[model samples]
Target: MRLFYPRGSDHEVTRLVRSDAAAVATLHREDFARPWTTTEFDELLRQNTVFGFAARVIGQPKAPLAGFVLARLAADEAEVLTIAVARAARRLGLGRALMEALLRRLHALRAETLFLEVDETNDPAVHLYRRLGFVEVARRPGYYGGGSEGKSDALVMRLDLGKAPVSR
Candidate 1:
């Protein structure tokens, strides 16, 4: 999970498009040790069950995104692929906004549950998820690459949107 960069309500979240893939890739490059390529993002977007939203400062619709959330759906389940926020935007509530938007979208798609895996060390992310009503469902040992020659555990979290409130 990452912070969405724009300050205040200056940002707006909208459905991501194929043209936004490069910009999203740039974000991954800046935020992740191992970044995904534009082609990878394109492929993910091309999938029928995959969709995402991009956050950008209003009035600068053409500007690179401040953050984005990608997810994939299968039947009643949806998994958050990743979330990235620009370095400039951390500790703000943009991440929460994106996730609220994500949950709403998933609910519209009839997703019964949402799942995501976050690095155990991301306290902010874990806290956010918990506060959003996600619970620890499982743990994946060494799922993320980092620390001690690229090895870190991941906490699997789940939110039962069917029983939770989602903003429209």
Candidate 2:
């Protein structure tokens, strides 16, 4: 699908293009403690069922890849595998924009529910998901490993896309 953002803006969100894999990988590595490699991204793109996105700033040749959202679709449900924004881009609303675009894409695919797991200690992400209408649905012990002190629990969140909430 073709995505367009107004020109001359400081930032813009665009669909993940074929050439974005490398940049995405770079951004992923910079943003996450553990990042997926370019080969992994290539496989993901070939799957034809995963949706990814990238946010860029205008006039930048390398488009630092402020953030990205990766999701998988099965039948009528979708799960967000990961979403991350570069450390410097965290407070710029890139994560929220990436997720909103991803959710809209999932809705078009007829997904009735969205599932994701967030680190229990990630308050900002938890708050963002809550504001996005995703509620705590379950918890998995030791879902994350190698935390500051040790392994940590992960909180599973879900959003029912079947219901049209007044807020976006």
Once superposed on the true structure, which residue ranges of model 2 sit more than 4 Å away at CA? 1-9, 146-148, 164-168
Clashes of each: 0, 0
Q: Lowest summed lDDT over 10 consecutive residues: which window, candidate 2?
A: 1-10
lDDT of 2 by residue, 1-168 (tens): 434342343667778766777777887787567889988886786677787877777557485777778888989888987788888777777777777788777777778999999989888899889988999899999878874778888999999987624223
Give candidate 1 regions above 4 Å deviation: 1-7, 146-150
RMSD of each: 3.7, 2.9
Worst 10 residues of 1 by lDDT: 1-10
Q: How much lDDT does each candidate structure score?
A: 0.84, 0.78
